[model samples]
Target: MLLHIQFSPEPIPAALPALSLGSETGAFVEFRGFVRGEEGDHTIGGLVYETYQPMAEREITRIAEALVVDHPVQAVRILHRLGPVPVGEAAICLGVAARHRAEAFAFLASFMDRLKKDVPIWKTDTLPAA
Candidate 1:
C-alpha cells in the first residue's frame, strides 16, 4: 500500500492526488474537513492548529500502516494544515483507495475517528466577541 502524509502551512489543495489503482481496485473515497465560521450561535473568526511534530507524523504513519495491515486498501493519503487557518478553508484531507467501496468507506471513517482520538494535533479557535 502507498501512504502519504504532509503537514503544510499553506492552503490545502482543492483536488487530492489520484491513486494509481490496480486492475482489482474498484473504489476511491475521500474526506475533507473545513474550517467553519460558526458553530450554532458562536462565531469563529479563525483557527490555529498546533502539533507535536515528531509525534504527530509518527502517529499518522502508524495509522496508515495499521490500515494497510488490517484493510483491503491500495493507497492512503492524508494532508493536514498547520498554523493559522481561516474560516471556510480546508483543515484536513484524507483519501483512500480500495478494491471495493465498502472497504474504502469503512477505512475512511475509521481512520478519521482514530486520527481525532489518537493524533497529537490540537486547535485553538478565534471567537468573536460575546
Candidate 2:
C-alpha cells in the first residue's frame, strides 16, 4: 500500500502517482481541483488556503488509508496547495492506481469528495478587482 499526503506551497506536481504504480496496477485515475474564475455570484480571482499542517495531514492520511482498505487500489497520492492559488491553478490533485478502471474512477471521485469535506484545510476565496 503506497500512500503520500503533502501540503505544498508550490503547484501540484504533474508526475505523482505515476511513480507509485505497482506491477499489479492496471488502471490509473488522476483528479485535479482548480481555482475557478467564479464562485456562485462572486467573481473570484484566486484563493488563499491555510491549514494546520499536522492535523490536516493526519486527516488526509486517514482518508487515503480508508480508500485503500475500502477499495481495490494499488496506491493513492494526494497533494493540496497552500498559500495563494491563482484562478485556473490546481489546488488539489488525487491519484489512484487499481487493477481496473472502474475502481480507480470510483475511488478517485469518492476520495476527492471526502477530502473536501473532511480535511482540515480551509480556503478563502479572493474576489476579482473592481
Identify the candidate with maximal TM-score: 1
What clash pairs does model 2 have? none
Candidate 1 per-residue lDDT over residues 1-130, each given as its tens digit: 8888889999998886666576877988889999888866778766889889899889988887787666778888888999888888899999888998888898888899999999999986564533
CA lDDT scores, all candidates in order:
0.84, 0.80
Model 1 misplacement above 4 A: 39-41, 127-130
Candidate 1 — which pairs collide?
A: none
- After the best TM-score superposition of candidate 2, give how far the Cα of residue 79 lies from its true spot, in angstroms: 1.2
What CA RMSD would you report for each candidate? 2.3, 2.0
Candidate of highest lDDT: 1
Give the 10-residue window scoring lowest on summed lDDT in candidate 2.
13-22
Model 1 error, position 56 (Å): 1.1
29: Cα error in model 1, Å: 0.7
Please provide, for model 2 over 1-130, each residue's C-alpha lDDT reduced to its tens digit, 9 standing for 90 to 100. Answer: 6887878999886666363465777888888888888777788788889898898888877877787666778877778899988888899887777888888888888787887798788886574633
Model 2 misses residue 101 by how many Å?
1.3
